[model samples]
Every structure is written in structure tokens, then in C-alpha cells.
Target chain A: MSTDIAGQAKKMGYKNIKVYLEGEPAWSKAGYPLYASNDFISKGNIVLIDLRSVEKSEAGRIARSVTIPSATLKDKADSIPKKAPVVIYSDSEDEAVSAMKVLKEKGLKKVALVPGNIAGWVKSGGETTSGPVVTTIVWKRQMEKGEVSITDFLKVAEGSATDTVILDVRNQDETTAGMFKNAISIPLDQVGNRKGELPKDKKIYVHCTTGARAGMAAKDLINAGYNAFFLNEDISCKDNTCSVTE
Target chain B: MQKTLIKFIPFLIMASFLTTGCAQTGTTVPQLIPQHGTSGGSRIQDRPYPIFVGNVSNVSNKAKVIAIDVGKGADAKTHLVKFDDKTKGIEYAVVGHASIINYEMRGGEPWATVIKAKLAQLPSGVTEIKTTELKSLLDQGTKFTLVDARPAKRSIEGSLPGAVNIPSDDFKAQANKLPESKDELVVAFCGGPT
Candidate 1:
């Protein structure tokens, strides 16, 4: 398999080809080193670079992985080190390969790309940095507003507030297995279609297995002229009705 | 008689002229061939995938182009292209079927290559490509938003990154709340078969 790769490179009339295994499963089952684009390269004379946008990098990135977005590589080529072994990775291999070329042009000789992207690395059991959880734009908004905890939502459900509406934004398949008895399922993708089904008079409380979808739903309801809240925590509606306190 | 006959003949000829001249033409003529295959017209888009163009090892060529895989072992029907140039490193085409894949940059051009599929074409709704390893990258001050399209409750923990919660149910009503700027990187995920 490797033999043809070199030949293919030669046929394309190029030298210095770096190889990446095609798929994540294959790479994982085979057991390989995978890391995020911004994976911390504190040791091994390796420099990890995060090619995601500045916003993503700000949220979290590998330790020491510089922010060199794929789009800005040409302008920022001089920053990379020539002596160190560099490994490029991203969720998108297309971006990773593009960045690799930018670096080579800057005269960095020792460079390679990760087989699978950061996701592949994690699936393959690699360690990484910890940071704040990302919330949906709606969740982010709710978090900013400081209203209702997961526990609070549960309390309302358990108490049977007549005016409250518990909306489950998970897909139908998820709801089929069982969900909060008081909750009505309206999947995220289908919300627009079923807008009429939702009650405008009710103060809606939204949720999902985790809080992200519920946050988004609550945000949507608020945007659509309905007052809504989200559960800050993930609640399992199985065995017993999940309450905010639980 | 001769005078009347001549007057009648004139009238007959005039009527014949009117009848023949008033008839509508209904035939279509072939138009000229276009000068170029797509002069003003758009190039037939690269098949659903972006083509990956890059350099291979030991070859003294400009750049080699390859079709990238859209999904896991899904075949090369819709591959995104990556261009690997020694001088430019790697640069991808903006108008391909696949989404722009990002990687680390070295110098002038990129030598190696990778590709990403379009969001709609991603293997499944729940394909968590970067879940296992993106956490630390997030820690490095790389700010990115991972969106859980699941309901808020399902995504309280075990998210790939500090993922935002966007319920698919309310995505449209809340689309306005999403980042309006293109510069903001947003990724959406669901708990489906990805």
C-alpha cells in the first residue's frame, strides 16, 4: 500500500509526500497517535498548531499550539520554527494539508500532518486540555441571563405548574425510548415546521438529555415571542420523572 | 367586359398578395455554437466532493490532485481537493462541494493534504469526528464553538468541547442568536448516527 503512494507522488511529479490513514476507524483500530490541531507539544521537539478560527482557539486549544488559521497561513508563515518537527492537524484534513504547504513555503522542512484530525486522536485515547463547556448560542444567552437551573426545571415538572410547558428538543428517536412525561417532543430540526403546535400562552421550559439542546430551544422560544427557560444540567427522565432537585 | 375583367383580375391579385403576405412564418433556425464550452457560463461544479490536490514524495512535479473521501470508507465519489505546493504549502479551492478542511501551516506551500466534507454530506448527524481529542486544543486558548443540536438537557456534560447547546427543535427560531459573523467558527452536532 505504501509503495503505490510513493509512485502516485512521483506520477504527480512531486517529492516529499506525507501520508495520513484515510478513515478514523481504521486509524483507531490500528492504534496510532492522534492529537488536536492545537494539541500541546510541550515535549518531543514537536510544535502543534491549531488551524481553527481565532474564536475556536480562544474557547480552547492545545497547549502551545499557535493560532495559525489555514486562511492566514501565507501571511503568517515566518512565525513557524524551521528546526522543530511540526505536526499539523484539524477537523478538516483539507485545511490541514493546505496549512502544511504554507509552512513548507516558509522554509520549515520537518513537518507532517496527523492521520485523523483531533477527533480521531480523542477517539484513539489521547489526553488533552480542559476548559469551559461550550453552550449553544441560545444556551449562551440563557447563561448570560441567569435564569433557571436544571434542578429548577425539574422542580416545576414535579410540582405540575399548570402554566409551564416542558419542551423536549431532542429528535423523535430519542424521545421514543422515553422522556419526561410532562415534556412534549419537538426536535431541533423540526421546530420551524411545528411552531404552531407549541403553546404561546404557556411559559415554556425546555430540556434534552443534556442542557445544550434545551438551552437552544429555550433561546428559540424566547426569540419567537415565547418566554422560556432551560435546564442547566442533564437529567435522565427514565425510571422516575427527573426533577430539578434530582 | 374587358374593363370589368381587368378590374376583377386586379382585385383577385391584390387579395392573393394580402393572403400570401399575411401568412406567419413558423420555422426555427439553428443558433451559432458557443465560442467556448463555458465562456460566460459556470463550469460544471466539481462533482459533489472537493478535489484534493497536493504533492507526493520523491516526485518532481508541480502538484498532484486526488479525490478525497466524503465519509468513512464511503468511496471517492465526492472528494474535496487539496492543492499541495512546495512554495505555497497547501491551498484549497473555495467553491468545492466539500467544506474547507483546515490543517497546520508550515511555510510557502503545503506538501501533505487532507479534506473535509460538506456539512450536509457529513457521514451522519452524530458523527463526532473530533470529540475524543479536541478538549485540550480548546484549553490552549483556541476559542471555537461546538454546538450540540441535541436538547439542552442532553448536553450538560460529555460534550466534545465546550459545546454550545442548540436544540434542533428551536434552531430556526434561535438562528438569529447564532453568530452573525462568518469569522466565528460554529460546528453543530446531534445524537444521531454520525
Candidate 2:
């Protein structure tokens, strides 16, 4: 947590700051119970993937963590959600960073690395569950079912002017270049929390710079009871005029 | 029958980015997507501008933008917010990060209704003092607590001449270390509500 942590407490009506020099290590040594960060596991919404081998995960792992391993991430690219904040951990810091790139490439929105990994978790007194190692890797079967084609999308967006809404699921920095003619910009990271803003009166069409994030958002919106579909193709825009392909 | 549908790639990846454009006659203005940073951030504005920082109320589970006070205690006025990415980086959460939304004072539409409406207040036993007042107090040698609510990583960069370092996170846990005097004028502060 950055000063933003303190900023939040103050915002919530707090008034002081103290220092713990030993940090998590000393607290762990003292047998203090270390808990997962709020952002990672709060509300059972965050998805944690263990990048280490199956043997390592089975030995002892953080509760509710999934397994995708760094190398095989490409194979399961569509499994992760674009808006949900995801935590990727492994045996070492290097492995975690390597695995993070996989998600970043897919534009999985906000991703973070757990510094301590299994060792750090142990040092911090986090409970270690050793068993058959139930995994959280629930592969999303065939997302192309809800796929929207470029021609079909252009038709809805520009065609008969039906009740079709274009949802853009990219970040603030990326949109400075420009956007689709009439799509709404609700960043992929905040889509889940901002679902209320989405209009249910129209047929929703979600898209991103690449189709990676759009696919994730499509799945999410559909599950949430919205008439939504993802434009699973590459698209670009400048000065409000966008060009779509595939 | 199994069929493979291959979609071409690398045609400008852009959507929902049009800030200044006219939607066709059939379409409406950009409604749902709040182009937050694109607006007031790039516009010429004075420092210490009005910025609302809180969960977007009314519409539950979403973060909205209504920067600045509007007579009502709903949103807060801007204070010295230390939004340094190095020492004080932003953190993301389910609700979203500390959204430092900047907006040019529009025609009193945003502040009238919606979003956070609670007046931010200082915690009990805490009183806010201005930098000038603090300096005066230091010059007059008024004995008081000048606690920097920042973490150790930030304090190492150097704090006030005599301000005690106490990261706000551990402040509650280390309450015993604070002055035992119940009457001591305790002043607490940190990167004000971002």
C-alpha cells in the first residue's frame, strides 16, 4: 500500500501515523497472523493464480489461489477477466513478473505481484493449506459464442440506429488518442464495479484496443444480466474517427 | 462440423475515446463514460483546485466525479495532497483507486446532486493546522505534536525539523507510543484526502 492507504484512512476519519520497523517479517517471527491484502481477496472477487509448478502448489499454497503457471498462460488467455484486479504469485519474484506480462499482453486491466510468494507468506504467518491442492483455474469455455463481427457492429452502431450501445473497456491513458464514433468509455479495470452505469434498455456492444479486454467484459456483462457482446477484433481511432478490422 | 474462425489483427485499436465530437443525429452525447482526466486536467487551471474524493454515493458500487465544494458539505475542498507516485503511489481496489478527479467548475450542474455528499471531518483528538500556523508555532516554540502520517519509506526522505514519524497505518496499533498527556494539543495529518 502507498500513501494512498494513509490517505484512505484519513478520508475515513483517522488522524495519526505510526511506524513498524520490523515490517511483516518481524511480525511473522512474533507469530502474528498475517492476512492477505484487501485488494487481493476482498469480497472473494480477486483472482490469484499460482505460477509455480503443480508440485509446489500442492505442497503448500495460499487459500483460494489458482494455478496457470507462467509458460502456459497464453493457452488460457481468455480465462481471466479484464476488469477484475488480479494477483499473480510464484516461488520467486522473477516468476511472478514473467507471469504478469502474460496477463498484461491480454490487457487484463490491473495486475499485481505478491512480493513474498510462498516463502514470504510463511514468514508473514499466512496460513498454508497443504492437500490435493484444489485449483481456481476454471477455464472459460468458448467465449466466441458472444462474439460480434466488425461489419455487424458497424451496422448496429451506424446502421438503422437500433438500441445498440458501444462499450469501450480501456484505460484513461489509452483513450487520449481517440475512440469509436459513439462507444462509451468505461475502463476495463472498473467495469465490474461500474455496472450500474451500463444501460439495460439497449443491446450493449463492448470493445477494446485489442479484443482481449472486450471479450472479458462481454462475459462479465452477460453474466451480470446485461445484453452485451464483445467485438473480438483489433480496432483503432484518432480524433474521434475509428477504423476497425476483422 | 468443426470450423475455425480467424479474425485479422492490427487495425487501429481505439474506441470510446472521442472527447470533443458530435454524435450523429441518431446517437446521443457520450453519457455513461465520464471522460474524467481528459477534461479539467488538460485545461488551464490554478493549483489547489476543487476536487471531490470519495466513493460515488447514490449509485452504489461505482466511483463518480464531482470535484470541489458546492456550499453543501457533500464534497471537500482541495488540500495539500501529496500524490507522489514514488513514495506515495496509488493503490487500486474493488471500488477503484483514490481517484484524484479534476473538473473545471461547470455551470453548477455536477455539485447540485449525486456522488459523495458527506462532509469530510478530522478524526477525534485531531485538529488541522495550516503550514503558516505550524511555522509560527515552531518559531514561538509552542510544544505540540507534529506527526507526519506518512510511512517510514517516506519519512526517510526527511521530515519536518522535529516532526515525529508515524505511518498512519500503524498509528492505531502504536497508540501507546504517543504522548501520554491527554491534554497535549495533538495535531495529526497526512496526504490529505486524495
Candidate 3:
């Protein structure tokens, strides 16, 4: 896509075409700073960390950012969820960069630096909160709309629940190798015509090998007034046993 | 006859699903048919040279090989290309990050000549920007258009503060978003090196 854009720019007679090939991932990995849009900084599901001293943070800091001073970052790293993107800001660029390295070394891949640190955030019309600083990092993986939790899906798969039915939306050839013992086979393309075969009272859980087709099937079932949810995970089954991975 | 028909119904359903399912999903069923073709011939000599672009799935520095995952889902395939001192930007081929590799067939395997996080070959007259230069430009509030060529979803995650999104997928349609002057300095970036 970047190549395509570069070609399009060249065709338009743009003389000075420059491509930042290493782009965002490289930039962030190097501890170079990034600017999260105000909306995302305020509302996005990210672990915003203020790396300023407790005194400075208590005076004023970006709203929703947990105060984790640069000095104590190494000790507090374990509390930070590796999956949630960590956005940090500090009094100085060096401090923030060091903190980023600390998190990265601790195996957090999604660490990012807020440009200009907290001062920049305040300068850019971002909201702030004063008073005591929040030190604890609290986060949970939020499910997308119409998605089922792995726990719930496993319960149904394990036959602990009888109120829900598992719908296998993979192709017939895929299931010929193996399939869930109680699952009803309905390829995604045939779901519309075969909707009447499923009971409306029972909750329908749609699943595919990689969840793409299952999501589509879930949407169709949802529109058809069936209580449907899709399992958004990689699932493989063989000999009546299934393994699921996120 | 009734019992036989009942037993064969599953096969009939399977046949119908294979035909209709593959058609609708645009995914081919993997076939295990034996091949009956001449061996020891130039497989790609007549075909246009292929360049594989994808995220690096694995990098075996010890083995001097990089495995790239191309395509997605059912059509996905991995290409293991051998690299050496001649391979450019080998350091940037980090795992799970984008890389572009153009290779030559060596002993029936692809041997990478160039491995880059960006285009394996840059268009003539175009220049590449180092990360530091971009950072300095943004810091100085340079009067140039910083374009985020990545998709909208990625840009939303985070980008340069003043960068405008002109996703490469919608470049032509969104040309108006670029500066009006053709001579204006424009820098475009995407998810590192793709």
C-alpha cells in the first residue's frame, strides 16, 4: 500500500517523494514519541501512564493516566498488562525513553511515548485531573460487539450448558477431518436458507476455523432475530477434542 | 434402498457444501491429487518475477533465513528466503513486522537479494527518510504535509500529531487531501516498512 501511494504521488508529478519506510512500529520501538489524537488519548482503551513524580502528578496530569514515575517504572512493570497499549509521558524526553525501554525489556511490545510528555498534552487542550494520583493499573480485555467470551463458548463446548447450540460454519471439507460432537454443521453460505432448522429459543453460537466466517454468520443470525454470538478465536478440533487460541 | 440412501445423504450434503461453500467464500478446497509434470525445468523462467510482501513470521538469524507470511487465511503461505551479507536492511526484518523481499530461485528455493521494511526497490528520484529526520521535522513544525499512508484504523491508533490520513488504499480518490502545489514537500508513511 505504501508503494502504491508512492507510485500515485510520482504519477502526479510530485518531485520530492520521500517514504518513511520503517514507519510507526520502528519509530515506537526506538522510543521515539507519538501523538495520540485527543479523542483516543481521552477515550481509547489504552493504559495511559504519567511518568512524572508523584508531586507533579498530584498537582496536575492528564485525565485517566495512572501515575507511574520513571524511577519506579521497572518495579511496577509487572502490574501493567502486556496486551494493553502503554502510553507514557514524563518530565523529560530521556526519562520517557528510558521508561519505554524498561517496559519493552519487560516484554511489553505496545509501549509508546506521548509527544512532549505531559506538558504537550496540557498545551494541546487535553483534559487534566488534579488531586491524588492513581497508581494502580486496572485493565481488562473488552469484547467487541456481538462477540462471545471464550469462557462461555467453552462451557457450551464442554456440554456443561444445554441452552445454547454450537453452529460450525466452516466448509464441509474442513469439518470432515473433525468436528465438535454436538455441533450442527451449517456452512456460512447456506445459513440464510437453513435458518429455520435452528431453534429460536436456544442461543446460537457460531464458530469457524479462524472466526471470520463465524462473525459474518453471527451478524446474519442476529438480523434474523436469533440470539447469536460469534466466537472470535482460532479453533481446531480433532477426534472429538478441540483446542482454542486467542 | 432406503437405508442405503440414508447412509449416502451425508456425502451428498458434503458435495453440495464443497461446491457452494468454496464458491461463496472464494476459498479453494485443498486437493491431494498427484502431479504428472516434467521435472528439472525452470518453473518461473517464463512467469513475471514475483515479489513477496508480508509480515515476518519468524527470523532464524542462526540459519540465515527469514520466514514471511504472505496472504491471509485460506490463501496464506509462508516463504522462507535465505539471506546473507548482500541482503539490504536485514536488521529491519523484525518478527511480526512488515517486510518486502524480492528473491531469485536458487536450488529450487527463494534466495533474498533485498529485504526491507519498505519497498525492496524505491522508485527512481524518490528518497527515504530516516526516523530521526522525520522526528526533527515534526519538532520544528516544518511547513510540509505529513501524510499517514496507512489505513484509517491504524492512523487512529496513533500518528504524527499534524499528519493527515490519505490511506494508500484510497489514494487516488483522496488526492484532494494533498497539498495543491505539486512541488510541495510531501512525506508519506505507513505501518513500518510496508
DockQ leader:
3
Candidate 1 Cα outliers beyond 4 Å, as residue runs: A1-147, A243-246, B1-194
Give the least accurate 10-residue stretch of model 1 chain B, judged by summed lDDT.
B22-31
Best by TM-score: 3
TM-score of chain B of each: 0.31, 0.39, 0.49
> Which one wins by TM-score: 2 or 3?
3
Q: Write the candidate numbers in order of decreasing TM-score.
A: 3, 2, 1
Candidate 3 per-residue lDDT, tens place, A1-246, comes to 454566678889988788777777777766665666667778888999998899999999999989988878889998887667778888898888788788888998776667677888888888999999998888876787889999999889877567899999787877887888778998765665678999899999889887766776776677677999999788998876788876
Model 2 TM-score is: 0.34
Comparing 2 with 3 on DockQ, the higher-scoring candidate is 3
Model 3 stretches astray by more than 4 angstroms: A144-147, A157-246, B1-124, B132-142, B160-162, B172-177
lDDT of 2 by residue, A1-246 (tens): 213223334444444532221123232233222223423342245677778878888888877778776777888767676655576678876667666666767887556555466777677666667667655554222335788778778886565556888888777766778887677899765675678998888889988877766766666677667899888777887887778854
Taking the tens digit of each residue's C-alpha lDDT, what string does model 1 give over B28-146? 00000121122343322221121222111111122232222222121212221224553232232222222223333334222234443212222111122453344354457555555
- Top model by lDDT, which number? 3
Q: Give the interface RMSD values of the models in order.
A: 24.6, 16.2, 10.9
